[model samples]
Structure formats: C-alpha cells, structure tokens
Target: MLSVKKLEAFYGDFQALFGIDFEIGESETVSIIGSNGAGKSTFLKTVCGQLKAAPSAIIFAGEPIGGKPANEIVAKGIAMVPEGRRLFRSLTVEENLLMGGFAKRSGPWNLKRVYQLFPALEEKRNNLSTALSGGQQQMVAIGRALMANPKILICDEVSLGLAPIVVKGIYDALPKITSDGLAVIIVEQDIDTAMRVSDRVYCFMHGRVSLKGRSADLTKNQISDAYFGI
Candidate 1:
C-alpha cells in the first residue's frame, strides 16, 4: 500500500538516506534491521512526515504523500509508535490514548479494542502514564497509535528497553493487531525478533539497503554479512 522510490533525505548538508527504495503491501509485515547510524530511524521519520522528501518520493495508496505534515499523514492512515514511546507523562493512561483519536479517522480500532488488546491498560486507565512500567508504557504508545485507526503502523524499537518476557507479550499481540489487514513496518534492533515477526527483512548499512529478502529464506551467514556490511 506504500511505495518509496529512490528516496533521499538530508539534515542540512549531511544526507541520511541514500536513494532508498522500499515498499509494503496490504497486511504485510516488513522489518528493517541495522546497526546504529544506518538510517533506519531516519527512513521511518521521513515516512511519518517528521522529515522532508520530494513529493514524488513517497507514494501511499497511489498518492504522493512525501513532505506532508505529520498530522496529515496520520489522517491519511499512517501512524508511528516512536523509539522512545513518547507518551505524555502528565496525562492519565486513558487520556493519553484519547489524544490519538483527535484525527477522528474511522476504523476498527477504538478505546475498547485497544483495551482488549492490552488488558493491563484497562486496569490502569486512570493512572499517570509514567506510573506504569516500561512494558506497560510501550503498550500505551502502541494503543495510542492504534487509536488513530491507521492502515499502516510503524513501530521503531518497540522492544528497546523492556525485558524479554515483556517484549514477547507485546510482540504476541502483532497477529491480532494485523488481523484486520493493517500493514506494519517494524524497525527493530533484535534481529531474531524482527525476522520471526516479519515476512520480509531489509538490512541497512551506510544509509542504504545492504540486503533484503524473505525472512525465512535468508541464512545466518547471509544476514551476518549483510548486517555487518561484509
């Protein structure tokens, strides 16, 4: 449902992405894996409209959406759960989730659905967002994005600081999250988790795609070489 062709991005004179070509079909799960400074996050930020690109670079549902405002992109059905799970610490759990619905997009995701997806949030609906544990906070971030009823969900480092078991709990919900044919792009540091959850994987190096292939088909040797730019 989204296609990025020869996409390039820059921060002042220093370019971050180098002619990156990426695409995701309806209901597909794609993972982007790379080391630090590989431009994984930059690519995502550009897609989410935090960074600028040529209007013809990003095509979503057959329309060029590059360089549009972030809110406009969210309204057009793309929502991102950022690396830090940037939740509003001052707001109650419920109130934080409610913020995502400000766009008023119509979809199957709502407060009730989100609660069902992560039952813990329901129990602490009135608690301050920062009062929750790291895992719970990540759930809130995902739920907040879901509240926007997006067609494509972009998750950057969803498992960054959480424990293994907690990460599993969050990852286990992916099937249900994508059951409605919602496309997902995951930028994960954990290669195993990224490979397991996604149908395809792209390895980035030096601001470009070093390798990409079906997750199940890529061998350890190939991924190792590609991941480290061998």
Candidate 2:
C-alpha cells in the first residue's frame, strides 16, 4: 500500500536518507530497526511528509506523494504517531484524541473507538495530557493517530521510556489493529520487540537498507551485521 523508492531526504544539505527503498503491503506490519543515526526515523518522516522527497520518490496507494504536505498525506489515508508522543500539553486527553481526527477521513476511526482501544483513556478523558504516565501518553498518541482512520499507520518509536511490561501491553494491541485492517509501519530500535511484532523487518545502515526479510527469517547475527554495517 506504500512504497518509497530512491528516496533521498536532507536537512538543509546534510542528507539523512540515501536512495532508501521500502514497501508496506495492506494489513502488513513492517519494522525498521537500526542503531542511532541509521535514518530509520527519517524514513518515516519522509513518508509522512514532515520531510519532502523528490517526485517519484514516494508512492502511496498508487499515487505520487513525495513532496505533498503533511496534512495532505494524512488526508490520503496515512497517519503517523510521531516519536516522543508530541501531545498538546494543554489539551485534555480526549481533546488530543479529537485533534487526531482533524484530517476527517471518512472511515471507522472515532473518539469512542479510540477510547475502546485504550479504556483507561475513557475514564480519564478529561484529564490533562501531560498528567498521564508515559505508557498512557503513548496510548493517547496511538489513539489519536487512529482517530484519523488511516489505511497505513506509521508509528515512530512506540516504546521509548516505558517499562517492559507496558511495552508488551502496547505490542499486544497490534494484533487487534491488524484485525481491524490497518497496515502498520513501526520504526523501532528495540530488536526484541521488532522481532516479536513485525511481519517483516528492514535493518538500516548509514541511511540505507542493508538487510530485510521476514522477521522470522532474520537471525541475531544477521541483524547485528546489518545494524552495525559490519
């Protein structure tokens, strides 16, 4: 459903991605794993339109969206749960979630459905966003992105500072999301989590994909090799 070909991203001349190629099929969950500075997040950022790519560089649902603006991309059925869970500090939990649907895509995502996914958010819907725990905040981020009712959900680092058990709880929810027919592209540094949750894995090295295959097909040594560019 999504494809990036020969994608090159730069921050004022310091290019972070070099001819990166990746694809995510419908209802597929793909993981991008690599060490810091490997450009995994940059890959997602480019896909989400936070960073622009040259025409023909990125395609989604068979259309060229390389240089499109972020909102335009969201409207085209792609939404991202960005890293750091960048929620509005002043907005209530529910308010943050509501903002997620501002794209107004016609589909199954709604505040009630998001609340159902994270029931805790229902009870504390009115609470301040920053008051929630890290995991809870991550849930809000996920719920907010879901509110867009996207065909492809790109999550950038869903498990950052949360506890192990909390991370597990979040991964456990992916099956439900896929069951609901959402394709997920998760950018994660956690190898164990990537191996467990991803259908396929792509390992990045120096702003390029060095290794890729089904998650079960990737061995520890192979992952290490690609991750370190060894």
Candidate 3:
C-alpha cells in the first residue's frame, strides 16, 4: 500500500537517509530495527512528510506524497505515533483521543473501538492524561492515533521507556488493531520484539537497509551483524 524509492533525507547539508527503499503492503506489519543514529526514525519522517523528500520518492496508494505537508499526509491516511508519545498533558484522556478524529478519515477505528482495544483507557477517559502511568499514557498515544482511522499506522519506538510487562500488554493489542486490514509500520530498537510482532523486518545500518526479510527467517547472528554494521 506504500512504496518508497531511493529515498534520501537530510538535515541541511548532512544527509541522514541514503537511498533507502522500502514497502508496506495492506494488512501487513513491517518493523524497522536499528541502533541509535541508524536513520530508522528518519525513514519514517520522510514517509510521513516531516522531512523534505524528492517528489517521486514516496508513493502511497499509487500517488506520490513525498514532500507533502505532515497534515496532508495524515489526511491521506498515514498517522504517526511519534517517539515519546507526545500526548497533550493538559487534555483529559478522552480529549487527547478526540484530537485524532480531526483527520476525518472514514474507517472502523473510532473512540468506541479504541476503548475496546485498550479497556484501561475507558476507565480513565475523564482523567488528566498526565496523571496516568507510563504504560497507560502509551495506550492513550496509540488510541489517539487510532482515532484518526488511518490506513497505515506508523509507531516510532513504542516500547521505548516502558517496563517489560507493560510492553507486552501494549503489544498484546496489536493483533486486534491490525485485524481490520490496517497496515502498520513500527520503528523499534528492540530486535526481539520487532521480529515477534512484524511479518517482515528491515534492519537499518548507516542510513540504509542492511537487511530485509521475513521476520521468522532471519537468524540472530544475521540481525546482530546488520544491527552493528558488521
């Protein structure tokens, strides 16, 4: 459903992504795994139109969307749950979730569905978002993105700061979230988690895809080599 062709991204004169190419199909979960400074986040930024990219670089549903504004990207059915969650601390849990509906995309995801996906969110709908625990806050972030009813959900470092049990709880909901054919792209530093949740995995090294293949087929040695640029 999405295609990237020879994508190169930069920060002024310093380029971050070097001719990176990737694809995500409908109902598929694709994970991007890499170490710090590996450009996994930059790849997502380019795909989501945060970084300026060549017009022909990113194609979504057969149309070139590279370099389009971020809002326009969300309107076109790509929503990002960025690193750090970035929830509105001032808003209540329900209000934060409501912000996602501003995209106005028609789909199966809605407030009710999101609550069902994370039942804990329902109990705290009226509480201040900042008052929630780290895991609960992460749930709110994901729920807020789902409110946009996006076709492709991009999650950057979803398990960044949470505990192991909490991470598992968050991941437990992924299957149901993707059950409705929503494509997902996950940028993760945890290789084991990425491989377990994704249908396919892309390992980035020095701003490029060093390895890409079926998640189950990649050996630990291969992933370790690619991750460390061996």
Candidate 4:
C-alpha cells in the first residue's frame, strides 16, 4: 500500500505538482489521466524518487520515503516503466531485463516467469533491445520492470506508440500481472483504456487533482469536464 499527502514537486522553482493526494491498496489498479503537462508524470517521478519531495509527503508500506535516491526507491519495492520504454540500445533483451534485477529483491518475477508473460521476449532474448519492434520493446520494458519484483509497479504511457491490437495485448496482460497482489499505477493518455483497466481513476489538470472516482461510477461528461476544465 502507498499514500501520498499534499505532494508537491518542482524543477528549480517551476512547480509541477500542487498538493496532490493519492493512495493505492494491495492488488489495486489505479490510473491517472490528463492532457499533456497535467503533472501525471511529475507525480510519478516524485513517487519513484526521481524528483524530491517533503519527507512526509510520500509514505510507502507505512514509512516515509520521499526524496530518496531512485535506486533506493527501487530497492524499497517500487519500479517504473517510463514513458519512452527507455530500453538500453546496447544491451540484449535478456541483458536489459537483468539490469532491472540489480536491486536483487526476492519475489515471483524472474526470467522464466517474464518469458511466460510475454512469449515473444524468450524468442528474441539475445537480440539487442533496439532491434525489437515497438511493441516487443515495450514488452521488454514491462518485463524489465517486473524483473525488479516490485510491490508497486508504475507504468507511464504503456500504449503510447503501439498499434491498437498491440496495445490490447499489453492491456490484456494486466490481470495476470496483478494476480499476485501487486499494486499498479498507470499513467495513461487514452481515457477509455484508463477507465477500463483501473478500479479508480484520477484526473489531473494544471498540476492538481481535478476529479477522482471509481472508474465505473464516472460518466463520460463528468470525466470530460474534469479533464478539460469545462
């Protein structure tokens, strides 16, 4: 479980998030949706320790972990699949996955399990990450994060550049990924997909939480109004 209270972030005084509060429970899937510059990514960065925050701002598994180093955060059981898929061009697919395990945490995810999750990765395990198709590269990114065996997995824009079918395949795997009680936070631009995949949804606008509710309870007009400040 994780809790964020009055979270704020900045880049040299240019603030990006404003008093945002959020929480996730075990095995829960939460989605964050907003337009560009809505601070979705900024909130994630602060959570994963890429950006600094007040010590009391972020409480994970009951302890305050704000402003810790990224590596330390990963060791504390939070892993992120960044927006760009950010795979290592020089490393082979398997090697890139192995990099994620540098934290050396113990859990259900490993090479064999990841391969089972995405059969394509096993077939091209030795190929350079850059050589894979966009979808496959995204698989490698997800697989890489899973390799960390994190309690909380954060995925940013997993469907960004992929084909619809490819995106579907990835989204379809969510049930399996979270079956082990892994909490997931997804930052998505596709509102429909976000609503479909998450139990709860948070809409961000201009660095603040504009609306939040159970995904099924939110009407299209409500989401539209919150999303666009209409």
With candidate 1 superimposed using the best TM-score fit, by how many Å does residue 72's alpha carbon deviate from the native?
0.7
Q: What local lDDT score does residue 44 receive in model 2, on the 0 to 100 scale?
A: 86
Give each prediction's root-mean-square deviation over alpha carbons: 0.5, 0.8, 0.6, 0.6
Q: Write the per-residue lDDT of candidate 3 for residues 1-230, one digit (tens) a residue.
A: 99999999999999999999999999999999999999999998988888999989999999999999999999999999989999999999999999999988999988889999999999999999999999999999999999999999999999999999999999888889899899999998888999999999999999999999999999999999999988
Error of 4 at 9 (Å): 0.6
CA lDDT, every model vs. true structure: 0.96, 0.91, 0.94, 0.97
Higher-lDDT candidate of 1 and 2: 1
- The residue ranges of model 3 lying beyond 4 angstroms of the native Cα positions read none
lDDT (10s digit) by residue, model 1, range 1-230: 99999999999999999999999998899999999999999999999999999999999999999999999999999999999999998999999999999999999999999999999999999999999999999999999999999999999999999999999999999999999999999999999999999999999998999999999999989999998978
List model 2 lDDT by residue over 1-230, tens digit each.
88889999999989899889899898899999999999988888888888878969998889999989998999999999999999999999999999998988898878877777789999999999999999999999999999999999989999998899999998898988887778999988789999999999999988999999999988999999888878
- Hey, what RMSD does candidate 4 come out at? 0.6
TM-score of candidate 2 against the unseen true structure? 0.98
**lDDT at position 140, candidate 4:** 97
**For model 2, what is the error of residue 202's alpha carbon versus the real structure, in angstroms, after optimal superposition?**
0.5
Error of 3 at 131 (Å): 0.4
Candidate 1 Cα errors over 4 Å, as ranges? none
